[model samples]
Target: MTPEHWLNIATHGLALEAAARVRAEYLAHLEDALEAGESAEAVLREWGDPHTANRELSKAHLTTREARYLPAGYAPTWAGLGRALGEDAVPLLLFALTALAELRSGETAITLALLLAIVAAALLRWLVLSRQMLAARGRATLYWLLSFPTVLMAMSCAVLASRGAEGWHEAGRLLWERGWTGLLIVAYLLYHFSRLLTALSAARKAEAQL
Candidate 1:
């Protein structure tokens, strides 16, 4: 069968409870617009894929993405900031934790220096990584990604990094203690989330509920 045919069959035949809810919701909306003469097929066509539908429903229930932009020290446009933040997170986390551990024991001078060295390495990775220039594209909404596991990972890492800095846990706190860095990442995630929500909320409703 063709890809579209398979997509339709698969989405229509899916038996998950959540999928049922989405289908039900779509139909409810479609029913309310019956005078418009739009069939479920037409509605689904505009809505795109079942994957997209799933993402919309999930974003309604979750925070969705993390580190969508760069911090105040980062001097670039939103796209540049997003790339830099995502690229920097892991290595920075590694460095901060390692450095903090050494610091707590009062002997991190060299270790701290090494962590400083990694800052550039992380920047290099961010510079060379396989990120799509999301902020650069006005149409790059993340709605079709929520149900996907990666979206959750992105969401979780961003959340942990934010709250990870707020308490007495020095290592974890230091990991995100760069103050504005946290804000940059949170703002970026928010922007990405807003786009995802807009797409999910605006998706055309389907008829003849599954």
Candidate 2:
């Protein structure tokens, strides 16, 4: 292939921000090879197929969907969906049950408060997920920030749970009366939040190596 054709293949998937630099670098490499008495086709052949070359060149500039955390060509299966959504699904089911119970008991305030809390939590979760999506767009800073609110919220919950355990006896009993589901929820949040932190760390490390 011609030099321009080779450059196109190698950079087809690269980010716009990095594409120019990468193209220049590849062009320089080709020029150096030509000056060394190498033919254009030989140089391109040594670099391998365009798709493979593109994958190599684009690693550092890959989006979150293209990163190692998500991988390229990720197909969604029912089992995978279950794994991804199960935690949120459980809370949603519990919320629905609690809402129904409150409605039946005519506790309008409790029902309203529960709905509002659910909405707020869902909104916060979406904010965090949006940050994660930004991180996938070659922004390492957002990946690092992914765990901040989760960690902060988890710590705050722990503190409140502790205070309730010591002085807020009635509230503690109420939580217990919920069959220890509060504890389970707290643990789930901690686990899920930590996983986000871990995934971001891995993705950042992988990108850095590129």
Candidate 3:
């Protein structure tokens, strides 16, 4: 290995260390915000910076072996997937995103999205997170429970148009009002509108509150 090799490898090593350090720093920044009574959006602002930090890795690309546990052509098994999620950190993130969603936005549209996300998280938690959680007690039940939301949501959507019940009626009405055909016609406009409203509301509220 020449200076470039030494430089690349040495830089890669430092980058990995720095990446961990920076990630910890980012977490601490988020924790500090939470500690200081800053909102989830504040944590989001603090955490988003680390992506630019990740780009620092672009100083040199790492080999596949250097990046992931598996070297080349390694296929994932159910056990691998389960083990990956079963870890402590994975649960923490699942909890964190769900927590942030709960804290940051608490309304119909946003709340529903977050709640759906929570179910997804739970599914991950049960199916995936438990794979990582070493203690692994009482997980089976939790996993089964997590499956309910996914099923419920799917069922809700399926029955939404077919039934006269309150939930179904609401779904049907929402779909009818939105008119999916028209949505595709004005998709970009609708996308822009939704994004504008979300961004504007966040900014407006952040300014007002601060």
On TM-score, the leading prediction is 2
Q: Against the true structure, what is each candidate's TM-score?
A: 0.23, 0.39, 0.22
Error of 2 at 96 (Å): 13
lDDT (Cα, tens digit) per residue for candidate 2, span 32-87? 99999998889888878888877776655543333434322112454433432343
lDDT of 1 by residue, 54-120 (tens): 4554544211121122111233455764655554567567757887877768988755654554554
Residue 190, candidate 3: C-alpha displacement in angstroms = 23
Clash pairs (backbone) in predicted model 2? 64-136
C-alpha root-mean-square deviation, candidate 3: 20.5
C-alpha root-mean-square deviation, each candidate: 15.6, 10.4, 20.5
Best by lDDT: 2
Count backbone overlaps in model 2.
1
Q: What are the lDDT figures for the candidates, one per model?
A: 0.47, 0.57, 0.44
- Per-prediction backbone clash count: 2, 1, 10
| Candidate 3 positional error at 24, Å | 60
Q: In candidate 2, where is summed lDDT lowest over 10 consecutive residues? A: 66-75
How are the candidates ranked when ordered by TM-score, highest leading? 2, 1, 3
